[model samples]
Target: MSAAPVIVIGSGLAGLMTALTLAPMPVVLVTAGRLGQAGSSPLAQGGVAAAIGVDDDTSLHLADTLAAGDGLCDAASAREIVGRGRDAIMALESHGVRFDRKPDGSYALGLEAAHSRHRIVHVDGDATGAGIVKALVAKVRETASITILEDCRALRLIKRDDRVVGVCLEGKGPVAARAVVLATGGAGGLYEATTTPLGNLGQGAALAGRVGARLADMEFVQFHPTALAVSAPRLPLISEAVRGEGAILINDRGERFMADQPGQELAPRDVVARAIAAEIDAGRKVYLDARAALGEGFVRRFPGIFALCQEHGIDPARMPIPVRPATHYHMGGIAADCDGRTNVPGLWAVGEAACTGLHGANRLASNSLLEAAVMGLNAGRAIASEMTAATVRLEPVSLPQMSDPAPVRAIVSRGLGILRHETGLRAAICALLPKAGHDDAAAVALAMAVAAFARCESRGSHARTDYPHKNASGTRKLFTMDEAFAFARELAASQPLSRTA
Candidate 1:
């Protein structure tokens, strides 16, 4: 393995920030598409979470993050990440990111659910993600130390003995690197209904698994509550910022449903998602009534969403927008430390693909972007401080992609969607167990299904409808790819899993 140039996989905010942090040092970025075009970072609408206002403190932000995580958040990681919020934002600003500012020259911080203060730093009205990505992409293109490899998807890890040396890409030779960073985001694309790009089918997790990196909290998948229920395949998101601006969730009877719940319209995202799911399951149509909340200014405040609604023949200023729950985020991934180093040497992970325990059971609103920036920068700095330069040989290893992903995707959605039951998860395992290694997609799907089935308790984003109460053993679930597949095989050979938990 070479130890001179660092290699970053995935070109979302995390990857870009990491490469930018290690500027003046040679780095290579491998993306499945053009930079900032394929991943969920550019699709983020809500502003990044931070503790920048005078009324807000990092302690309060940490508390909200822990509360949302359902006791799964690591206290130290939460403190470290949330504690660095202001500096992260300032660092981005220095790189040409334009955030919304008040007339007094301070930031116009907006509020999202689960926060006690208005500390959501936004830009171009509701285009916080687009603004950050645009600036970073421009900065990367201008930098001479970074090499952008567009249209290259990393299919597998090139490991020697126990450590990852490089990656094998689709239709290409193995490229050696000193250190490899994974920022491939989430597995939401495995679901038929999701807000993330369709290509995010958990390939990164599978790659890490093949190299024996420990994956933790694989059961907690966070479903966003308010995807616009247009008949289209991929749903457009209705920003939670719209709800923060006073919009409310309502049912078919034109009643404010969230009024009866804690935090009302601004409850934790898990609670709100479940509430909406329950409404839809009960044959009631759910809608976001924003006409009375923002009126004429809705068009100006959210021009992108407003235009999306208009294209679908709905007017947000006059009518309630139909909404439903869709798989939005994965809180579990490659288990890594605060420095983004995985258990495997020379391999690191960050962003949604890394489970640092900062977001335990559920992520707080808009914290995804914050985690991306902070952890990406940390990974870059950590590797830069320790990398050793040396020459090495490159070896390409044959790895398998998922075979027949459609059936696996359907099973995962039915078994592991908003509300999960024992029967559905087991059946999903039985169907997916046979194709585990042949398809990375099926392997990742089986891993999540098995973890969800083994948890046998409800907590955070992982709600088990059968075991409807939280248990005292609030331990995190960890796994290896072989371990997960072995369990699935044994269980599949036995009698079917009973639903009488």
Candidate 2:
């Protein structure tokens, strides 16, 4: 094994921040693509959320976060994450990110759905993610303590005694490190439609599951409401900030249907996504009407969305954008504390890959960047406090064979996309569990279906159609991969092959 003291297995905000915070400690960063290309962070259009307003306090931010989590958020974790918001903003600024400022010299905060106050910090009006990543990548490249390997993929965790001692890379082989941080991002690619980068197939979660780490909230995948309905692998994302700026959703009949609903156009993502799905399912086409609101300034203020629209041959100034729901983020992941400590010792996770209970069942808009920065810093500091290098031996490894993800992706899109049902979920699992032997995503897909199947009521982003109500009381479920598979096998045994899960 290569003798890097610690190995971070991604190059997004969390991995970069973790390495940067570790400072003098040398860490190896392994990325599957270029430094900022394949990561979901670079594709984020909404800004990071922070309570930096005089009218806003940490308590309000905490309240909003808990409210969005749908009774599943860990109070302490939410407090710690939201409390550290200002410092995270300062830290990002120190790394050379310039947030948009108002005329009076305070931050130009924007409002998103479900937030009671204006507390979102952005950059370049609509290119917050790109701006943040650009600054961070510059800082990381200049730092002498970090070594980067582009196009190197981390395949599995190398555990010696129930603890991750190193990571096994695809072609570069295993790199040994006592502390391994899994900052690999979400699994939105598990479905046919997504706003996430195409490679975000929950590899980190699957690896953690294989190593016996407990996963939570697998059923609560958040779908964004306004992905452009184009025939692309990843649909172009129309930022939620536009809705905050007064854009309204309309169907083919030019009717603003969301006007009658609570929160109007600015409803929480899950509610809006469900509404959009209902429209699409009823053979009605939904559109985002920005022409009347932003008009000419739309092209200037939000060049990213404008460029996307123009590139697709539709002018936002003249016509509304066709829209539909697509998988955006996964709220459930490898359950971890704020320090990013997983159930397995020597293994840590942060960013979208770790379920820190801050997002609960639904992620408040723009809170993901906040989680990545705060929790990444916390993980780095925690690891720095306990630095003891030990000699480790490298073992030969073999990767699991994976087939084309399209078939399973189609199943996930049908059964687990926006709404879920018992029969459809059972069919998805029954189709996937057999294919699980050849593909890793199949297992992750099966896990999600089983988790959705187990939770017999709707809560937050996980809406079960057959069980169309929220349970009176239920805690987050923590289960192993074996347990999920066992449940699948049992369900398959209960019925005939033509009707079984």
Best candidate according to lDDT: 2
lDDT of 1 at 346: 86
* Clashes per candidate (backbone, < 3 Å): 1, 0
lDDT for position 277 in model 1: 91
What C-alpha lDDT do the candidate models reach, one value each?
0.88, 0.88
In model 1, which regions exceed 4 Å deviation? 1-4, 401-404, 496-501
lDDT of 1 at 388: 73
Model 2: which ten-residue window has the lowest total lDDT? 492-501
lDDT of 2 by residue, 1-501 (tens): 345588898999988899899888888888989997777998888799999899999999999999989999988999999999998999999999999998999999988999999999999888998999999999999999888989988878889877788888888777788699999999999988999987898888888888888888888899999999999989999999989989999999888989999999898899999999998889999999998899988987789999999889999988999999999999988889998999999999999999999988899999999999998899999999985776798878887665688887888988887788988888888888887655778878888889998999888999988988889886787787778888889988886356323
TM-score of each: 0.97, 0.97
Deviation in angstroms for 4 in model 2?
A: 4.0
Evaluate model 2: give its lDDT: 0.88
lDDT for each residue of candidate 1 in 1-501, tens digit (9 for 90 to 100): 334578899989989999999887789989998888888988888889999898989999999999999988888888999998987898898889999898999999889999999989988888888899999999999999999999988888888767777788777768777888998989998899998888888877988997899899999998999999987767899989999999999999988889988899899888999999988889999999999988899998888889989989989999999999898999989998877999999899989999999999999998889999999889888888987764668755666653767877888988988788988888888888877768888888888999999998889989888999999887888899889988988887886654322
lDDT of 2 at 124: 89
